[model samples]
Target: MTYRKKLIEVALPLDTINKESAREKSIRHGHPSTLHLWWARRPLAACRAVLFASLVDDPSNDLPEEEAKVERDRLFGILEDLVKWENSNDENVLGRAQAEIMRSTGNNPPPVLDPFCGGGSIPLEAQRLGLEAHGSDLNPVAVLITKALIEIPPKFAGKPPVNPESRGKIGNEGNWRGARGLAEDVRYYGKWMRDEAEKRIGHLYPKGPNGETVIAWLWARTVRCPNPACSAAMPLVSSFWLSKKTAKKAWVEPVVDREKKEVRFTVMTGEGAPRDGTVNRQGATCLVCDTTVPFSHVRAEGRAKHMEQKLMAVVAEDERGRKYITPTEQHVVFANKAKPSWRPEAELYGKAAVNVPLYGLTTFADLFTNRQLVALDTFSDLVSEARKEVYKDA
Candidate 1:
C-alpha cells in the first residue's frame, strides 16, 4: 500500500484512544512498523521519549551517548534562548507558543486566544502572523504584559526607553546611585537603623577583622520589612543576634548602658519593660518617618511576645470563674480588669510599593472560536469557487 493509504489504515483511532494507552498497546503488540509511523507523525512525542531515555538510561552506553547529547543540547539551547529573551525583555511562553502555531499554519495564521495568557505569548505571535488574537489571564501581570506586547510597535519590541547617559554604566559611581535609591526607597531603612545602633555599640560587641563588627554590619545592613508594603524598602531583614544563644532570633531592643559602658539587647514584644533578659533600653527612631519602635523590633534577639502572661492568666481565670458572676456582670468585671496599665510604644515604619511587569499568551478556546472554525470549515468551499471562476478546463 502507498504511504498515505497505510497511514489512513493504521492511524489507530487517535481521536478516541488516549495517546499513552495507544502507545503502550502498540509496544505490547510488538508492531515496530506502526510504532515508527506513529513516532514519525508526532515529533513532540519522539522528543519526549528522547528526554526520558537520556534521564533514565546509563550514561556510558556509547550508541545512545551522541543522540542523548544532541537531544539535551537541543532542549537546553531552546530553553536558554527563551530564558535570555524573558530576562532581557518582558516576553513570555504564550507568545512563543502562538508564534509556533502561526508558523505551522503558514502566513494566514488562525485567530488565537490565551485563557491563561501569561506574559502574552500566543496572542502576540498571532498578531504578528496577521491574525486577530484575543487573550485573557487570571493574573493582572499577564494581562498587562499581553496588551503591552500586542499594542507596542513591533520595532520597539517591548523594551524600555533607553537613557543614553545611563547606558553601559556600572559600579557605585555610575548607575549605583539610582539603584541604591531604589534599594533605599524599596529596601534599606530597617538595616540603616540597625547599622546606626551597631556603630554606637560595636565596641561593646567586638570581634576579629571579619568578626562580630563585620558580621553585624552585614546583618544590620540587610534588615527589611516582611509586609508587602515594606518589601519595596528591602528584600529581607538582617539577623540581629551575634550568636544563636538568644531564643529563636527574636526582634531585640538594643541599648547602650552608658554608665556600665556595655551594650545590651532585649526581646521586643511591643509591650511592657523588655522581657527577663532585656538589656537595652534606648529606642531607635525612623529618620525618614517619625515612627519609633523600641530598637528591639529591629534586633534579632527581641522576642515578639506582644501579649503579657499575666493578662492571659487573668483572662483564663475570669473565664473559669464564670459560675460566680452573671454573664452581664462578668463582662463588666472582665472589662475593668482587662484594661492594660502600660503598653509598649512601637512605631509604624513606612511601607514601600514595588511594580512588577507581566506578559500575555493564548488559550485553546481561541483556536476553536465560532468565527475561526466556521472560516476553516468553509475554506475548501471558498477555494473551489475561486478555482471554478479561474479555469474552465479541468
Candidate 2:
C-alpha cells in the first residue's frame, strides 16, 4: 500500500479562516494573547485548522472520481466548521473534529510539541483538541505564558477559587469550569491592589485647576541658549498643535519675558494657527532673544545633566471633555515634589540601533520621570504582595 496525502496538503478555506482571525484580535476577555505582548502571534483560526487537517487524511487517488469528490467535500465541511472563532470552545464542534482526528490516526495520534512556540498558539490549540501538548521557547516570558495557557489551567481547571471574596460569591461548585474562578480572584485582588496603591501615592496626582481630575501633564525638554547676551532656556519641540480636530484647533504659544530672560508657554485654542516649534535639523531658535543655538550645545547640556523640563500644558477631564490648562507655579511645585530613591542604572542596548543615547538618555531608567519611577517602584512592591496573596488562597 502506498502512503496517502494529509488533508493539510490540499487547499484550505482561506477567506473564512482569514476573516475570523481578524475578528479574534478584538476579543479581549480571557484570551491568551492579552497575557503578554508577543509580536506576530499565530491566529487561533489558522492554528486550529492546521492541527485538524494535519491529523486527517485526504481521499486516495485510486477511488472513482465521484467517490473522491464526496470524500473531499466531507473533509472540507469539517474545516469550515473548525475555523469559526465562535465555535472554538463548543464541545460538540470540538468533539466532531477530535473524533475525525482519532479515526485517521487509528486512535493513536502523536503528542504535539512546539519547541519555538513564541506565544503558545500551536500547543494551546493542540491541547484544545484533546491532545497532549508541550511547548518551549528560548525566552523565559514565552515559556511562562505557554505554561499559563496550557499547563497551569489543567491543574486548576474545574476547581472553585479559594480566595475568600470569590468563594463567597460562587454558588454552584459544578458550574466552576475552565479558570472562571481564577479570573474572578484576579479581579478581586487586582482592585484591592489598586486601592492600596492609591492610598500610598494619591497625593502625587492632584486635580486640574477647575478641580477636574488631572489625567496627564505635558512637558518639553529644554537647554540653556548658547548666546550669553540672551541666556533663555529654549524648548525643543517638533510641533505646537495639541488637537487638529475640525473646530477644536489648539496649540502652544511661547511668551518670552525679556526682562527675566524666561520663556513661559501658554495653551492657545481656536482658529488662529500657532508659530513653528523651536528645534529643527540644524539648531533651535531662542524664544527670548531670537538667537540661533546649535544642536551641539543642546547635546552638551544633556550630557552634563543641565537639561530641564518645563510644563507646557496640563490635560484634565471634566463632564464634557478634556480641558487643557496653562501651567501655574502651584502645578510646577506639585511636579517638583517627586524624589525617587531607585532607578535602573543599567546601560542601554547597542548604540547603532538606538538614538536616545546621543542626547544623554543612555540608560533604561532615563526614559521615565522621577514621579513615574516612584509609581513603578510602588507597583513592583505590590506585585510581590499580590503573589503572596495568591499563595495563601491556593
Predicted structure with the largest TM-score when compared to the true one? 2
lDDT tens digits, residue span 1-394, model 2: 6786787786667787788788887774556557777777899888998998888877764457679778878877877788787888888889989998998888999999989998899998999899999889998989988887788878877777767776666373647777776766767788878998999887788888778998888999998888889778888887888888767787889888999998888998988877998888888888888887788888888888888899998888999888778888888887778777789888888653277776888888898888888889888999899989888877
Compared with the true structure, the alpha-carbon lDDT of candidate 2 equals 0.83
State the number of backbone clashes in model 2: 0
Model 1 CA lDDT for position 119: 56
Tell me which residue pairs clash in candidate 2. Answer: none
Looking at model 1, residue 388 earns an lDDT score of 54
How many clashing residue pairs appear in each of the predictions shown? 35, 0
Model 1 lDDT vs. the true structure? Answer: 0.33
